[model samples]
Target: MENNTIIKTSLDPRSTFDKYEKRPLINAVTTESYEPKPQAHNSKIIIESIIHGFDNFRKFSRFYAFMGLVAGSFFSSLLAVDNLSQLFPTFFNGYLQYIVPHFFMHLYIVGLNQLADLEIDKINKPYLPLAYGEFSFTNGVITVASFLFLSFGSAWMIGSKPSLWSLLVTFVLMTAYSINLPFLRWKKSTTLTVMAHAIGMTTSFNIAAFMHMKTFVLKKATTYPRSLFLATVVMAIFFAVVAMAKVFWFCVSLLEIAYGAAILIGASSPFLWSKLFTT
Candidate 1:
């Protein structure tokens, strides 16, 4: 009887409610999901910013590749200037001084475009930082302004007139291309947009690059080579076409790449024929 009474007492429901006897409540702590601050330039933000800023990193990569080839295919200038083993390093150093600053300028250019095209991008390219709401308008403004200041300031510091001019001209062009204010938004006008983009991307970039390397690196008088002129013409059309295709088609297909290749080859054929005849 005593044993049964003890068992009954231990089994009491009120006793089971003792806090001390309670096992740690499984998942007792309520978990709340956290959404990141929209404009925070934290790790995720920084990564997205970089991805956006440096998107199509090839935009400027060809500058180096083409210029490097122009300077020398094998440890010397096409004119056979020697001591290039040492001079090549010098060339790269100067190139970086000029190109690195322009990188920030490129960032500003692309960011400004995004700011103006947020709605279109949401439907077309939602992964963009601003389009997806990861970046706010204020954040976009601040970042774009900072990049602009950095690019302009650094170009001035480099003391290269060609470099500074390149940044200035490209900025003005891109600003005009993307800004929505009256008389400035070239994107609304197909002809104006194409003209501005082609000129800004091709003539400005190529001519400025040639001037920089020639005057700054080769230490020579500014002279435009035939090949350089040819390059600008071809690349200008290519860039314009690509821009249109990308904006309208939303992607650059392999067929477009093959088309570009054919264009390049066909465009060069005339020059090749003339050169062959002359040589």
Candidate 2:
């Protein structure tokens, strides 16, 4: 009887092993079926995405470049208004008025450029935040649009005529150059690109002069000097010529021209000379 029982156990051993193995498989299937699927999109996820998008935008834009541009514009305007000695005393006070508006204007331009160039950037510069998916398209558009509105509104509120005109012109020209609107994307052509940059730089130079006159000279002086206008035109012509060349050496040459022209204009103009020498 014991021998017969052992024989039966040996023959049925495979059946017992199969039953135990199948139990975990059935349990796994049941557990998976009951598990919740992740939500594809949600408010929390969206908020986090947008926050990341802003961070990416800031990094891609190169914050220091914007600061340098604003500083150049501010100091150029100050020099137009007063001599070096006189500028030191009032520099901080005047900088405060122009900084916010200039910052927003620069942000608007850079944001628009990045927004429009997303596709090109993927091929040419994949590391860009927008190209790399670090920043969402919708958030980028909203951020740029906000900067545009803030720039214009702040310039208007400050009542700085140069700041207002500069912001408006820069926005319009940069939009035309960067946006893919029909017949407006000037960035496609080398000639148009150079032309756009030249015009933008020239207008920015004028803006600095206008800001200076408005801030320091307009109230005290009866007539705006002709020499200053001539100097601005000369600077613009030189800038446009050098910018068209589009070479590194040309850019350096333009800076030298700018300094020489500024000094010549300041020294020659009776009004500016009187201001510089008299006080």
Candidate 3:
């Protein structure tokens, strides 16, 4: 009887210990599942914000603006070619056949911008498609190549003497700007480079004229009838003014100076149909 009673007591202690363990385990499970509802709600908001931010990110690309500027520069010059002939009477007779390639010159400017600021763009413009790992260098090459091909091809098709020569000059300038601007240290040669770029910018307007007239030399005319001459002059002045204005608006640097000059000068070349407005 004593042995049986001792066995029962030991078994009874084990049963109690098991019951105690079960209660703690049940409490732990309940505690773990009982998270505050607000935390779950806040997590959903975080997820939503991330999604929305990405949507906004795509809408803000500046590539469109850059492309527009390139296209505008080309089209505007085409408009002025007819009137430019009035200013330089012999332009068509002597140089009319070379204007076909003039349309592609803008590519030189855009390419130079891309090449010069590549490293800086990677850091300052991390959000840019190129830097964000969204766009590949191959894509850039394709884009530029397509622009050149279209512009030059169209110029070739036009078969205008001036257009062809203008195209050649543009190609050469682009090559020079891409290859030698760095050697000239145009970024560091502030005034001299700015003036050279300005001359190039001003020349772009004439190149556009070449496209319209299909020639480069002006004939011996007393006065050109088109008011576009005045408009070209005005745009050139305005572009120069804006170039200088950059000093007041932002900190001046080699890159800024070179680009500011480029933009202003390039901007002047595009004011097509100036006569339509003036008269």
Candidate 4:
């Protein structure tokens, strides 16, 4: 419709045909020459890519969820306080060794899940790096692979049996939950999906982290103290909510309400008993 656009296109045969066909976009985008921006040095490109990779890793990994895992590990370790003096150096050193590899394992699992659910994520969680196209699929594969390598390699290097088992089982369950391969992709099955996450969270996060502190960090014999009930509470509170996020918002809300009510009831029970006994 603009005189400038029509006059410009009238000169070029290709543009003439486009006008003859009455293309809507003919006037929409001006025929501007496309030029590639000046190339950065190869080393610069590599550095930028590395920076993007780290940013993508941060985007993909849930820091709050990861911190919850860390908190679980921290408290579980406290459950195994055999000797106060051991807390000074031995416990701190051993906890770091367990945590470092676990962090890598956490990245691998979350990254792998995002990679596998790229298409679904565009619908469910478009803000995710992979879904948003900020992180390419090829780079996702590379990052996840690197995390997997670091997870197991560091665990083995430290010669920690608890960390080894922790990473191993978590890897297997996460693979089952996310990968699209045959007999995998447990997310397709309601039963398998819940089972995978329940076991993964309860066992890998709850038991493994607890065991790491009890055995490796504190050098204590494996014993389930009353304090270890904290792990069970964690499993009950967190496991289903995350795993069931796929299913129904109602269920997630229900679990939250139930947990909140339980906390209130637990807190009030002592006062209720005092009234009963006094009466």
Candidate 5:
């Protein structure tokens, strides 16, 4: 009877409740309030931001652009080949020399456009990295700058006059299109936008033509045929029309116009026809 009385006294309900209640407060004041050191925490944040930045960059569809560039390069090289014996060599060499550099060039242009359009994107594309606060503007700028550097640097290494000139011209035009500081944001006006796209597309096609011609020259063959020139012009016009159509149309209407344009261009260019048919 004495032991039972002692045990009941020690097991007081109020005391147990007090002890249990104090534990959470103690944890709140100590462990719950504790933070990891700033160095590791900040490093983690920086790494995550970089990862998100790249994820945002991939949203630009870089792989598709890269593959398109590669295809263009290969197709142009084939058209430039006057003889079957030189085909494989020209195709391989041009692909090796041109595709990587052009990919970076296109990437630079895309990054600049995104950086300049952050505010507009908030209303139009809130899910974008900058609009959603996933990528800081500073990091975005750094990324664009890095792409610009890689593009021009790779072109210089290639040491091709056409590649260098094309990169330079494209860079200047894209800067005018995206940068507002010098009052050259052509994206504001539909006319200017179409004009810019026209010129940009023309220049891009010319770069492929030039690359093709370079490959032929290296093999001591005649320059690219007049057919190649015609094909390039038709393709340029097709791209320009498609770009304008995108600004004006939506949904099925846009697809109809784009497909119609593609069909017309394809019909006009034996090179494009052959390539498409072969594929």
Candidate 6:
């Protein structure tokens, strides 16, 4: 059979072997079809997983983000001084007073928020990177320490109050308001929180006034120029109104909306949209 298969060789026009002096050609081997396997790992997939991990962490750590927002708000208040001068041309420039107090306020607010949420965090916010065991305790301590040092150091740099005593007093008040365990629990109580809010507003307005008053004093200007007195009065009233509004809104405003919705629609109505009014 092998001889028969080899003996019937014939030259063909289409065959390259016939044109090339009858050289023998090997047949191709074909056992089965195969495909190459992909690489063990894709670089793009690994990088995407890392990015997704960070995004997930950020979404879970809102309290830390809130602390950052509070710090930004302090800076916002500091810049508001320029705007305030425009509103009241006679405004005194208490630059250090306004800026320092707010820095301290935000630092303490952030620390207190974390402390206040310790319990709630243990329950509801455990997934948060800050509250969870993701960041080391030492890291959190360093972060808080850095914030406090910067805040108080800046206060010392530009404090308007001539006495270190006054600066120390202000720092102590803020720290106590924020940190002391039993003596003054400001964050825990709604009433205390609202009171602190009023105090904060008062401090901000006074800082504006202090800047103006100090400028006038430096210039040896006459006793409290009467022209700006009406504006100050209006501003003080406005501050008071705003404080009350904030307090009211903080307390029963949501409940009020729920009641109003019940009256207009039904008791089962969702309050998601209505909650914006409170905010």
Measured against the true structure, the TM-scores of the candidates, in listed sequence, are 0.62, 0.62, 0.45, 0.69, 0.66, 0.44
Top TM-score prediction, candidate number? 4
Query: Model 4 Cα RMSD, Å?
Result: 12.6
Model 5 ranges off by over 4 Å: 1-54, 60-62, 206-209, 212-224, 246-279
| C-alpha RMSD between model 3 and the true structure | 12.9
Tens-place lDDT digits, model 1, residues 40-72: 638787898678667533331234534432332
Query: What TM-score quantifies how close candidate 4 is to the native fold?
Result: 0.69
Residue 59 displacement (Å), model 4? 0.8
Shift of residue 213 alpha carbon in model 6, Å:
8.2
RMSD value for candidate 1: 8.9
lDDT of 4: 0.77
Between candidates 1 and 3, the lDDT winner: 1
What is the C-alpha lDDT profile of model 3 across 193-218, one tens digit per residue?
44544445445554345334432233
Query: Relative to the unseen true structure, what is the C-alpha lDDT of residue 5 in candidate 6, on a scale of 0 to 100?
Result: 50
Please give the lDDT score at residue 69 for candidate 6: 30
Higher-TM-score candidate of 5 and 6: 5
* Per-residue C-alpha lDDT of model 4 across residues 159-238, encoded as one tens digit per residue: 88978987888899889889999999998887787778777766655677678878877667888754455456546556
Candidate 5 lDDT score at position 124 = 95
Q: Which residue pairs clash within candidate 6?
A: 92-211, 92-212, 93-211, 93-212, 94-211
Off by over 4 Å in 6: 1-101, 126-128, 162-174, 177-180, 205-279
Tens digits of per-residue lDDT, candidate 2, 189-255, equal 7677767776676566555545544554343442445544654555575655554565667667767
- Model 3, residue 221: C-alpha shift (Å): 9.0
Residue 137: error of model 2 in Å? Answer: 0.8
Encode model 5's per-residue lDDT on 1-279: one tens digit a residue: 999988997799987899899999988888767688999999999999889767876775346655655665567655655577765765566656766677788888877887898899889988766677777889888878888899889878777666677677778877888888757998777677767776676565554545535542454434655546655665555556655675554434645654665556556655765547533
